[model samples]
Target: MAEKYCVENLAVSVLDNLRYQHDWTELQILTHSPVDDLPLPRPLISGLPPRRLYLHPDDQIEMLKSHPNPEGSIPETPVTEWVLPVHLAEKWTLKAFASVFDSMPPENSASPHRVKRVLLATVHDDSTVVYYFMHDGIVKPRQN
Candidate 1:
């Protein structure tokens, strides 16, 4: 029998891959979203990475400036991952990604300070979910 295709299943698969392979924590499945104020083909995923993923340069500078001591300052909490979950059978476009991004909160809605970037978690038939970070706008090239 052929497998059923649904966002519920897709999200579970992606979450499994994240927990088993990347060791992400505090995962959540987000629903109740509207693409351009309407429904979508699927839902999205959110979670934490094993370590910090991206830190805004402005936020980093603010942290550095606000630290009481020059040495041994406390580190900021890692931001959550806003994931656009997809299945192997699905293909996406820039427009598709944009819709998802537009629908998402700047941070986790439950915790406004949590997430700052979006991630695409593409789940394959083989149960591997490849992740790539997405930015709302063009960013400066990284030093390395």
Candidate 2:
């Protein structure tokens, strides 16, 4: 039997996996009308993770110096992260990744020109998925 081939299907699969495994919330799929002339390879989705994924080292140093309450630290606000869903059978290259960033629909952008960083989530045969964080451009290196 052949595997199912639907953009929405693949996106949804990853979304469900994210919610279940990672405790991601407020997931939404960004759908765009096909331009015919200009087309993206896959649909992009965004969601909020339970904790911060990217934190600046300088901020952390400041926080440590200030000495925050550790027992019940309340997060100021949660930010949504982007997701690029791909099937387990699919293969991606730099060109493929560039294409996603190059022509991402405005719906994915937080502002007019701001392109959000994405999490590349790949769904497997057993409905398990692996994720990798994908940043838009060069950024300051974070501590390990």
Clashes in model 1: which pairs?
none
**Tens-digit lDDT string for candidate 1 (64-115):** 7788885774475776777877766776677877776666764634654423
Please report, as a residue range, the 10-residue window in candidate 1 with the lowest summed lDDT. Answer: 32-41
Off by over 4 Å in 1: 1-4, 34-41, 60-76, 108-116
Top candidate on TM-score is: 1
lDDT score for candidate 2 against the true structure: 0.71
Top candidate on lDDT is 2
The parts of candidate 2 lying over 4 Å away from their true place are: 1-4, 33-40, 56-76, 105-113
| Position 4, candidate 2: lDDT | 70
Residue 61: error of model 2 in Å?
A: 7.2
